[model samples]
Target: MDRFIWSNRGIEAGETKLFSQVGVRIYDGDQKTSYDDGNINL
Candidate 1:
């Protein structure tokens, strides 16, 4: 499995929401992988 850190900035409210979200893909060479959906469609 891989690890990642995602964030949602530019949100109008402090409450958690799906808008303006960003994803950081942390790759593990042992496992061949890449983003499959959403904005990070790698």
Candidate 2:
């Protein structure tokens, strides 16, 4: 995805590109406890 943003055939004129940070969480079987939490770049 980052490669495409840097390529010549990138976003068109008058267009916009947006990036967001995503978060992930792993829950236990009970669903009441979170085992892990992390952030990822999409």
Candidate 3:
């Protein structure tokens, strides 16, 4: 749902490129989560 809205705005704003997400996060029975989204070079 968020992607649809973002793409609409991006198109109208002439956005032609993107550098994004590079990781995952999950929580188990231990109530622990892991996330690693590195860096955004741009």
lDDT: which candidate is best? 1
lDDT of 1 by residue, 1-42 (tens): 525534433345555544433454434676545653434311
RMSD (Å) of each candidate, 1 decimal: 7.5, 10.6, 8.4
Candidate 3 residues 12-35, lDDT tens each?
354545664445343355554442
* Candidates ranked, most accurate by TM-score first: 2, 1, 3
How many clashing residue pairs, candidate 2? 0
**Candidate 2 clashing pairs?**
none
The runs of at least 3 residues in candidate 3 whose Cα sits more than 4 Å from the true structure, single-residue gaps closed, are: 1-21, 33-42
Clashes of each: 0, 0, 0
Question: Which regions in candidate 2 have their CA more than 4 angstroms from the true location?
Answer: 1-8, 20-42
Q: How far is candidate 2 from the true structure (C-alpha RMSD, Å)?
A: 10.6
lDDT of 2: 0.43
Predictions ranked by lDDT, top down?
1, 2, 3
- What lDDT would each prediction earn against the true structure? 0.44, 0.43, 0.35
Give the range of the ten consecutive residues with the poorest summed lDDT in model 1: 33-42
- What TM-score number comes out for model 3? 0.18
Residue 9, model 2, lDDT: 55
